[model samples]
Target: MFDCIDWVNLPTFFSMLVARSTIAPVLAAATETEPEAESSVVLAGVLLSLVAIYFASKIGGEICARINLPPVLGDLVGGVVVGISALNLLVFPDSGALGSDSLIMSILQSTSSLTPEALQVTFEAQSEVISVLSELGVVILLFEIGLESELSELIKYGPQAAIVAVVGVVLPFTLGTMGLIAFFGVATIPAIFAGAALTATSIGITAKVLAEIGRLSSKEGQIIIGAAVLDDVLGIIILAVVASLVKTGEIEVMNIIYLTISAGAFLVGTIVLGRLLGPYFVALVKELKTRGPLLISALIFAFLLSYVAAAIQLEAILGAFAAGLVLGETEIQEELEKQVIPISDMLVPIFFVVVGARTDLAVLDPTVPSNRAGLAIAAFLIVVAIVGKVVTGFTVFGQPDIKRLGIGVGMIPRGEVGLVFAGVGAASGVLSDSLQAAVIVMVILTTFIAPPWLRIVFNDSDRLETVQEE
Candidate 1:
């Protein structure tokens, strides 16, 4: 009878065994008396998650390329796919999403590194560490965007670029905002969502389209690129303004004016100051010698502006984007390019995949009204996104020697940055799911459409070299 009772209480015995083993050190660590044990655990978990985000991002990118999509698409997909799997692996070693979690991987992980009594403490440490690591991943991703710009071309073509960017951003925003308010009968939040969708522009994607048709150096091409860059800066400001108005129920016109003025002022100031300080900044970075002071300093620079951007209600990426524009004109561009491009090339894909992954098509059920509404929104958006960019082809109004339309068409792809907007908006809850999908679909369509369209418009191969000489 006593033996039967013991058998019945086996689970209770195991529970106490597990609890007794983990409690003492955790209690000690919580009280901050066991500082060494706690630090060691937190440090290990953070290192593991960071390592995982990078490696998984790289693999996902390569795999995505094999399937004919942007490596960014892969990385984003990989982050979530890999992240979910990693989480499971952390919880249950044999979950079979992949091979057994490696011994090396386990050692680096606070959770798996612990034995007997420290298990729960290690797990608690890991959750916090993982969150931090993911935030680091987002930071690195934006920093990469800053490193990819070209300032000379951006400047030489500044006026037209500004015109196109402003036209592109302003028109779409106005149209989208009005369309929702009048046609859809949506409230201010949804109307803002529509304008946010209009702010989407993929600078990298547009450049590649022009290059594909060898029109990247055309008068129109330069104008499109320059304007698109500026357009991004302006668009972000507009987004901040709209977001602020939606949130606070006041569109303080003075505040809006001040925000706009500050953005322009920051751009002008950074360029002037950075030009004078460029040499010292570059030399200082070189002196730091693998300490990554330049990169770290750049991040601090990016974040400072990001905070400023956010304070006035803009996406932090916009601040980072402006910082990149200044940095591009500095003496450090080459070294910055050399050191950061690969990492950017790797992590950027992760940002893309996140966009695709967040788009759960199931939410738009084939048989439902929301699904129909989503499809309709996507179609209208596709037209607006394309027509709006195509009109930029006319920006070469004063310069007819260029294939302005070709450049305009080339400027169409939404690429990574556009996806970043889509992802950030969705993640931040500023956009409804239907709205998110509509914008992403429009971005993808524009990107895919431009390549073929560019071939048709810039059909002459000789003009490409001639444009270079002129």
Candidate 2:
């Protein structure tokens, strides 16, 4: 009977059964492996993005440095060139860009086995990673600024700084809000949001410029830094109030009070507590035997405070700045500052470049039918943004012979801060397309103009002072 059934055929039938038994496990393994493969693709995208950012920053920075401009401006320019407005090499999802819109994504797709769906997921993941890194860059930057600043000087100029902050907030807000309502005929909520946008002062850009020019420790620089810090706190409060208005159609008094009080308390408490704990911190770092014990420990402290600040609904950069101020009072401040520079060099350009990259210059294109009205409104906002902050320089009562113009110009660049306001307004649907474009244009112009303008103002002031000294 076995011979009749064909003995050789029995082995083939047995092998088929074995193959069927192994198929399920093989599929399961592949299913598990897919996520890892996706992760690798995301990482590769991020690596390429960084490469573009570093290249743009260096090239733009080099050109700007060569032309007697702030190298920071070059970083911004570099960002614009590689960003959504130009090459599309460093596009972001938050900017209403598709994965197909990014050249980097295209390159990734051509080189890898990424499917259409995988490309979308990888693009978002990569953008988010870059965004976080950019945020961290600014935090490190503020921390470095704190280290370089003299806390005593900042305190001494606190009152003057406070006045500048108050004026800077009230004037631009009042003018921009009313101007839009009267001139542009915008709705009340959108006008309020735009006004609030103008209230921002990008301390990062101003501080970086001041440092590059070796004026960071000057009296005016101290006042500018102090005022900018205060402006940030006030800006946060206003943003909360407006964002609340947008969502609920009413102001939230309790929320506003909470933000105000918490901001004030956080800044003051962090500084006071940080000072008291500074010696202990230094002592702890001294005991660690690691190669970068001091630097690593300082970063840990900064990151902790940054997290705390974020948890409390404040800007993390504020906490980083506070940490710097605290540790700045310690004995190892000088050594720590030296160690932090290389880190700053690597990270800070990412912040500036990302800010530039996120900025879409297409909004300013008058050829676009919708942009015409926006360009007109943008003109008005640009004027208001410049004048509103510029007038604050005159508000400093006791500081005779201060570079009042430089102080005002330093406060002009809204930089990434204004963009936050615009983004929030757009997200809430409170901003019309024209109004949003206007806000963006105002931001872009002020950001690009202020660096060079501030440089000129300071350069002129330096020359005048030299003549006076002579």
Candidate 3:
């Protein structure tokens, strides 16, 4: 077509042509933005989930505090309140609709009656982000624990901590494995995995309890912290071996031996090497002009160690914990803690709520045949989990003021580590659904009971100390 163009507007016409050519493709891609838009809804759901968890935790914590209980109990209970098992409060959408239009969804919008598939879909969709947040929260929490911890104290009590860790790991692993085999009649791999679940004591929970009671710096608290850290190292080693067995269907003795040595080496090596180098790194960062460079630098260090630990097949938290230990020894320890505490407070509750959300009482019902079987197995495992850890407290030698019972109870909460073990097993098809549910039951009991019980023991110890002084 021959075009008539005004001389002054010629540039405008060409510009419009260029704009039309480029803008058409851009507008075409706008159709594809629907997927991205859909993702925004999912993001909103995640944010809402967080908000629900936060308020639930706050309310739960307040109620707990009113009754002289640990606030974490409330955080966990709040998780249950919003979780699929109880209130069905926070469900994500599988379709782009966010499930608002679905009759079932609408009916249960303010109540707790969600379809299993919908809940699961939502959970899996948001699982990755929530998992990362939960993990980072615990890492910060552990780092704080490390800051409050002294290396010399960790070393002085190292032998006793080692003994307590060994006892704690062995008893739970043995009892859990045997009980799964004998009582639940599960496969060897699942039984081993179940045992593995019981082996880790959530240092986050134990440390928080001790810190709240002002015992975190006490001799016994130090021992418990040391032992819990060591217990995690050992638990991961066991998990690695069991996972390999599941994959290869054959146990590799040398592989297990190598993993054990490597894990130990990595932990000790990090401590020794970090002790030599951490101060220099901190000193280098101290000259930075940024307002929060020190805190960021510490976080970078923690994250690097976490990545290293993961690369070597250990838990990332181990690396974070190691980073804290190293940084805690530096002169900037006080400043780091002051800066990090607010971050820890904000993120830690999310981790606890996630732990609680994983609990499903529906799986433990006595009315269903399979659930009854799971319930029975769960009951047995709970007893084994409790008594085994309690006995390990007595294994600590010669610290009469140690509050051995408190230490044992401190070891009780299986927390996230247990869930991780169970999850791996379930994913690998090693743990049947019911078996996983049973493990979840055992974890919840331990997680719920320990905080208050530990507080009670600590109070009793305080009273006894006062009486003796009088």
> Residue by residue across 239-323, what tens digits does model 3's lDDT show?
8888889999887888778778877888899899998997688778978997789999999989998898888778888888888
Rank by lDDT, highest first.
Answer: 2, 3, 1
Q: Model 2 — TM-score against the truth?
A: 0.93
- What CA RMSD would candidate 3 show? 7.8
Cα displacement (Å) at residue 160, model 2: 0.5
Candidate 2 per-residue lDDT over residues 67-91, each given as its tens digit: 9999999999999999999999999
| TM-score per model over all chains | 0.65, 0.93, 0.85
Q: Which candidate is the best by lDDT?
A: 2
Q: What RMSD does each model have against the real structure? A: 10.1, 5.8, 7.8
Q: Which is the leading candidate under TM-score?
A: 2
What is candidate 2's local distance difference test score?
0.94
On a 0 to 100 scale, what is the lDDT of residue 133 in model 1? 37
Candidate 1 on 1-470: residue-level lDDT in tens?
A: 67656887899999999998899779877786432335766576556545655676678768855754445445545654544333432221211222124332355443444542354455455554554333444555545445555556667777777777777776777777777677766577766766666666766545544544455556666676667657666766665666566567666777668767876776677667766776776677777856778777776776787677667655565566667767767777667767766665554443443333333334335587666666677787777777777787686556656666766675666655566567556656767756766776676666556655666666654566678889
The per-residue C-alpha lDDT of model 1 at residue 360 equals 36
- Runs of candidate 2 exceeding 4 Å displacement: 1-37
Question: Considering summed lDDT, which 10 consecutive residues are worst modelled in model 1?
Answer: 91-100
